[model samples]
Target: MSAFRARPPAIPTTLVDDAVTRIIRWDFEPGADTGVHTHGLGYVVVPMTDCHFLIEEGDSAREAFVAQGAAYRREAGATHNVVNAGSEPMSFIEIEYKQAL
Candidate 1:
């Protein structure tokens, strides 16, 4: 197991929720975290502010940097917790794409 500890869950604001997608704004104070979760649908992340992330999976942790306005996409089925490791607050928008049900 890793020594990584997650702080309080980051604040989430849902901006849009429709059949096609779910858009959410995640705001994190320095050291705030997104508790462990698994992604059920493909998604894209658009950084509103430059993000310094400390990502913790089952037994490992890593750091990532995403510049403001840089959007990235990912497939589903990933599980992890995210922490804001920078000194300042940061936020990002997540748009999850729904699959045919």
Candidate 2:
């Protein structure tokens, strides 16, 4: 378990969890956060709505803007806290690829 404490936890809803992939829907209210964590598997994120994010890793932080219908992919083992930096709620579909068994 992580030693760091998470603020408001982001809500995650599982849509699929099969042999090769795991899909989840994440909903974040303004100022909510996904906590500090690492991605164990490579993942893709499809934005369900336009999103403004504050991504923090260690002491560094950056802002991101993703438009609705835009998608992005990340490699495994990336660690950071994802926060909703905008005034409204934001959501995205996250698909994590599982290695073949």
What lDDT does the true structure give each of the candidates? 0.93, 0.91
lDDT of 2: 0.91
| Root-mean-square deviation of Cα positions for candidate 1 versus the true structure, in angstroms | 3.0
Report the Cα lDDT for candidate 1: 0.93
Worst 10 residues of 2 by lDDT: 1-10
Please list the Cα RMSD from the true structure of every candidate, rounded to 1 decimal place. Answer: 3.0, 2.8
Please give, for residues 28-90, the per-residue lDDT of candidate 1 as tens digits: 999999889999998999999999999999899999999999999999999999899999999
Query: What 10-residue stretch in candidate 1 is worst by lDDT?
Result: 1-10
Runs off by more than 4 Å, candidate 2: 1-7
What is the TM-score of candidate 2? 0.90
TM-score of 1: 0.91
What's the residue-level lDDT of 42 in candidate 1?
Answer: 87
